[model samples]
Target: MNKHNAEYYISKLGLLPHPEGGYYKRTFQSEEQTSDQELSVEFEGKRRLYTSIYFLLGSDDVSHFHRLKSDELWYYHAGSPLTVHVIDEHGVYKEYKLGIDLENGEVPQVLVPKNSIFGSSVKDEDTFSLVGCMVSPGFEFQDFELFTQDELLAKYPQHQDIIMKLAYDLIPV
Candidate 1:
């Protein structure tokens, strides 16, 4: 186990509380812009080629189910493995474990395709998982959509357990 706790990494990395959950710090934002023609009309204008952030999720916290217009790739960095749950466009539920334990079936990288609703959690108590997420065509607040438990249940009642665990009734500011 890592001797450093969640607080240690938060302080060391200068992470701030993320609206979704846990802590994060934007690490990179590409200066290059993507051609507006390459993206959907909802993009409005050209966006940075890509953006990256360091995301940390603690045992008791969950990254709420949210949708992004762009695809994201998660790379495990430290601590225990984390599980990323996703509901695809077709309403299929899937899970990806991110960690270095290849023998245990944990992958070093997990991809959340565009238009997928996804969230993540660390399963072990007193432990946290750190990862880096890279988003293509960058990430814009206008393209992010957060859902409430009730809202998601209406669309995906079959995922009641996960929705109840990850979706929030009220998001804290």
Candidate 2:
């Protein structure tokens, strides 16, 4: 076994600024793929934080907004039609759609900061994407917060009463 210090490896993992939050760093890249049906790595672990990968079914509205104690990176592997949205600390939100001004080269990626919210939507069928979250204090499944429409409406009724800025597309499954 290759014994390595977790802290050392964490530093080597390369953390970068998340587009949504300022409290975390994230890095996302693609891996060699021999087939369209290959399993992808969603998350990687090193020291202070780990990574997460996700698979979005085509046309399925996937909730993206989430706040983590760490940073997150999203890498688009297969499937051309995809949309990602994020809300910054200032409550400024932006949505990105793939295939629009999309360059033909490395897979596109998105960075999400700690304590920020973000979400994604898949337009093509049979789509796969990878997400990497680097938690400064590491991550625990218990810390995962999956929000629902009713719950969000109940919690932040003031925000919901406004203009319905957030659209409910998917329920936790």
Candidate 3:
């Protein structure tokens, strides 16, 4: 197989434009569901135990800051490395490089805990990245929240630069 660009993955994988940015296609939803009694009070009904998607980001694309009710695990698939910026529930900020490079501190998989604000971008300007994300307790539209610039800045005043960069709308030309 030959290396391809973001457009290739988007078309081949049948990815759609994602609200938080990037292109993605849900690839899995487990038949098993968490029992209502075992579920968090925030959940109104039973939910699939797990879900997964193929996510792609081009050099110019940015996965805006967003949060989910369930923890999300990211697995690197191909293309260039991606930088995932995260602000934990405690307000601590961190960056994780997602790729196959272990010598340079890149990790093939990373976990973003529930309710942690996060975003991502292709590490190299001319490249793209393809990754897989798995969310436990499944992924429901109701469980997702995209952060607004003002709202996020209010909560994380110290991360203004990055917040502004990732929070702005990316109107495609």
* Predicted candidate 2 versus true structure: per-residue lDDT over 1-173, tens digit per residue: 22132232224444332222211233322332232133132333323324443333234335435565456655554344456666656666666664433574233666667666566655455442323333433454444454545665565554453214334435434
In candidate 2, the residue pairs with backbone N, CA or C atoms under 3 Å apart (3 or more residues apart, or in different chains) clash, namely 16-26, 42-52, 42-53, 43-51, 43-52, 44-51, 52-131, 64-118, 64-119, 65-118
Predictions: Cα RMSD each:
1.8, 14.7, 2.4
**Candidate 3 Cα outliers beyond 4 Å, as residue runs:** 169-173
Q: Residue 153 CA error for candidate 1 (Å)?
A: 0.8
For 39-147, candidate 3 gives per-residue lDDT tens digits of 7647778889999999999889899998898999999999999999999999999999999999999999999999899999899987899999999989999988887
TM per candidate comes to 0.94, 0.49, 0.93
Error of 2 at 87 (Å): 1.9
How much is the lDDT of residue 127 in candidate 1? 91
Instruction: Single out the weakest 10-residue window by summed lDDT for candidate 1.
Output: 1-10
Top candidate, metric lDDT: 1
lDDT of 2: 0.44
Query: Could you give the candidate ranking by TM-score, starting with the highest?
Result: 1, 3, 2
Better of 1 and 3 by TM-score: 1
Sorted on lDDT, best first, the list reads 1, 3, 2
- Candidate 2 stretches with Cα past 4 Å from truth are 1-48, 98-107, 124-138, 150-173
Model 1 residue 169 CA deviation in Å: 1.5
What lDDT tens digits, residue by residue, belong to model 1 across residues 142-172?
8888889999999999999999988988765
